[model samples]
Target: MRPPNTPPARAVSTPAADDTPAADDTEFRTLLDRLSDKATADYYNPFTTFDWPASIPTDELWMSPELLSCHGTELMDELSPAQLRTLSRWESVNFYSLNVHGIRELLIEVTRRVHTPGFELPSEFFHHFIGEENDHMWFFATFCLKYAGKIYPDRSVKLPEAPRDPDIENFLVFARILIFEQIVDHYNVQMAADRRLHPTVRHINRLHHQDESRHIAFGCRLVRLLWERLLDRGPDEAARHELRGHLGGYLGRYLTTSIESLYNPAVYRDAGLPDGFALRKRLLVHPARQAAHAKVLHKTTGFLQRIGVFDARH
Candidate 1:
């Protein structure tokens, strides 16, 4: 087990290179083009991908307690044996609910890119992105709707606008989107390996996980190139600081989004936890969950710091 308080493994910083990345940029674009070509032919329509006629088993647990965010006082050593099982079930549903909501928003953003001027190339990847996220949203909703009879709506987690300049909005959006995708990708990978999950849940996760590997690859390459491209253009120090601040807040939100508002903590109140809000606080700060939080956030954080977006001394 990872020791408590030991910082999670994260990438260290490197000085920003001050040269043009024309060759590297071309190489990255070529790779994305190849992925677009492959996706154009190989993409599966989400509508036909799954057999939705099967009934979801309501009693089946979708998440393990170990996977739940650590902030709940009723978790781990604090829970009664019976409550532990319920906690596991709640966490699973909570996880799926967040996916349903987040994917919906991301799909909205991606769909806007399709067939638009200046985004024609990215529109190819968006086709694949929409296809994958639509399937993801469907199965997650299918489980919730079939078993629970409703899908949860988005929680209130609106982030403050990051520094705005026409010059930096493109870079900022690239960073923001990448940060969100990386966190989701972490959960997808982890859940795919969890044997306690029901078969249908596992099948959905495995398929989503398989597709996200490519999305992450594309996002990572694009974000890196975008950052490099921006840095080469030489923003002022104030702009750099604003970008870092935005990234930090975005990172924190990405890490804590599910823990903060995804579940009706009131469910815990019904489950014999003192009150729902207290349970929310407990889980939000739990060491194990926090570690998992850091694990996901690190993908984007580490990349940013290494690429000179979040310098330590600043």
Candidate 2:
């Protein structure tokens, strides 16, 4: 049975050729073909890719210090060096856990649309995307389970019901995927380059970053294409304004939710911090943390604004 409050699934329609977006434009087709080739050339066996150490040292940093939720806050001064290290360990696990959960959600959404009428042109690249993401989920989950002995439960709030309009739904899905990847790639790029982290930690981040580059490239182009299609529908000025406001609002909330998930209470409890809930609440709104969130999302928001998915003032 469909879950309560879930939006009813829309039937996939084979819209008439003229009704659909020109997704087969020469530029888009070239991008898909190039990315598909890159995916083929870059394929690797995840199971054998890394030398998983029997254990990572608890005293060492598992995650980069600056990426921690409490970084740059007064709370940083309150925690001892040992406490900071412990926090980093659990936070690293939490980060990977988020990746596993996020990748799973995107995979399901993409799988639903692949080979469907409006998506026919990009279905080939979808195969590559799906395979690569499945591999990512595996490695991330493996890292968490093998080292931490547990993957943190996904703490994200359930998203609101999706709009019944298929074009809107499709645009939102790809936009969400792009935003998620861009946020994750920010972390991946940082950790992969931080030499203080363990080699295994660095290796996984580096590998994920490599594949994510291709995925992000594809996502940016496809999201822009989808947005263009929506605009081409020629709604009245008021309707067009409403559509833009709705999309901007939804994506803004999504970005906030994604950032908040990084501050899991369970991570705090495991790290030996008292009042995990209160700490989460306070840290979420802290001036420094707010700035950090903006930095993390800078690239994503810039892209969205450039594509007109977001207003310049937003």
Candidate 3:
């Protein structure tokens, strides 16, 4: 009945303000404090993380073919070999473009919260986070611009729009973003260690992988705390049901991408392919992508399983 922005009539509940972390939402505040301490102790100079003295190999493949497009064959197995190669190159561009765009968006989100009134504790570490992501965005774009020649514009995946329910919206955003980063982290970690990659490329991944480990730690801690608080609100059964429904929808709907849809099928038409949508459909369920999904989704899957959000799928 009151205005939507009004605080809950009752005091918002909080996790036990202790300084330890746990899986089942016990001692969350305590856990966050410990996480903050770790970030401080483990801080590094981003500029020095990679030695720029190293030259890069322009002809070397930055990505593997299994990670590349099958000329829409996964969905539209009707392409010529030439078309598949074009699809492969475009898929590479698309992957790096998403990284470029997604990191920028995350930078904005963290920046807004970093200096805001209620965000002090988390923002302290986010200061480091923003710096690290800035470096990541630079390196991702560096490769895209230097090699691919142009960064692709962002694709439409309008995720932030939510229903009228505030609790439902907040929970959904956290869950979706958590899943997104978890998937990308798998690639970053692998490329970081791949000796075949140019030093710059490997350095980029190594730096990002290091920072992401911390980001995941912080994100998991924050989401678990937030989830506990949401469940404890003195809501009627219907409101609680709606919240749970929102969580389930996010859990199921947004965990993975359809790789086939990644490179525009027009790309195939230009390259002389028969149909775009069919090819996209084929690629979406390709074994390589499924493996990519499994690798990136591992941590999120574990988190969700522990939280009882999804039946254990692994």
Candidate 4:
């Protein structure tokens, strides 16, 4: 990441010579207006929204079986039913902890751009986005600390050095946020509807999915607009191809890393499993787990391809 004091590479305020809203720009503004209004209408006080139970039963599954990291692997068969339930508890805590960290990082990134030069058009909705995400971070952390006694410390490693180009940097920031939300929403949508899980678990997941639907919509449109703007600068075919390749490589690594983070050794240890690190490594390479990761990322990868952020050949 660039130093906090670094200036944006290009100011988005500069438009084509005519400086009029293009057709896509008009559509984007329309979306902003509609989504902002929806946010206002749908707003709730997260503080009072959930009737958090005194205790969530440890005997019941805290996470859906299908969403578990070991879901399709032979590891699942090896674990007894009681052990699976225990594992779900730690896994659930780990999942919510990830949300807390993810929301924090995204909030910082979005805040930096909220009212800045290139972000004037969406700044209005950015208020709603920031507010809602803050609420999300709070509720997720509340759940973790209230039940599990700790929010798992963020274990994600530093990513490879990013390109120095400001445009690519901006695109990557929002694109990564979108990818994170999409992958999370995949689990949210499933767990929210799974009757087997506790009502408290289902309720939080349901509420998150409600808000994330809007955020994801906004993110998709914004990423596409940014990519189009990059294209409008008229990079040569070779440069455009290179940009695509770089973006593909970066995003692919991000996707893999995101999946791997779910298999935390701490989660295994908390669940009373031995050799947590070895187990995590084994689970990651299992063909079934790879397929599960693909399923989780399917919507996100498809969206990137549609927006030309990823080459179709990939």
Segments of candidate 2 deviating more than 4 angstroms: 1-24
- Give the Å shift of residue 259 in candidate 4: 0.8
- Candidate that scores best on TM-score: 4
Better of 2 and 4 by lDDT: 4
Give one digit per residue, the lDDT tens place, for model 3 in 28-96: 445556666776787776656545643344345555444455522343355444445555555556666
Alpha carbon lDDT of residue 264, candidate 4?
Answer: 92
lDDT of 1 by residue, 1-314 (tens): 00011111111112237734447655765877877776666567666776765664545556655555544333567765566666656656666777777777666655654665545446667777788778877888887777666655555466555444543454555555666666666767767787876776677777777777778788777667666656655578787666667655554454455335534575565456677886677667667656666665676667777877765532
Which residue pairs show backbone clashes in model 2?
none
TM-score of 2: 0.93
- Clash totals for all candidate models: 6, 0, 12, 0
Ranking by TM-score: 4, 2, 1, 3
What residue pairs clash in candidate 1, if any at all? 70-283, 71-282, 71-283, 71-284, 72-282, 72-283
Query: Over all chains combined, what TM-score does candidate 4 have?
Result: 0.95
Whole-model lDDT per candidate: 0.61, 0.86, 0.59, 0.87
Higher-lDDT candidate of 3 and 4: 4
Regions more than 4 Å wrong, model 1: 1-22, 37-42, 52-60, 71-74, 235-272, 312-314
Model 3's alpha-carbon lDDT is: 0.59
In terms of lDDT, the poorest run of 10 residues in model 1 is 1-10
lDDT ranking, best first:
4, 2, 1, 3
RMSD of every prediction: 7.7, 3.3, 6.1, 2.3
lDDT of 1 at 205: 76
lDDT tens readout by residue for model 2, 1-314? 00112222232234456764443466787898999999999999998887888998998999999999999999999999999999999999999999998888888888887877667778899999999899999999999999999999866876676677878888888888998999999999999999999999999999999999999999998888788778868567777788888888888888988899999999999999999999999999999999999999999999999988799876
Top candidate (lDDT): 4
lDDT of 4 by residue, 1-314 (tens): 11112234444445446989878878999999999999999999999998988889999999998888899998899999999999999999999999998888888878888778777888899999999999999999999999888999988866776778888788888888998899899999999999999999999999999999999999999988888888777569888878788878888888888888899999999999999999999999999998898899889889989878776654
Decide which is better by TM-score, 1 or 2. Answer: 2
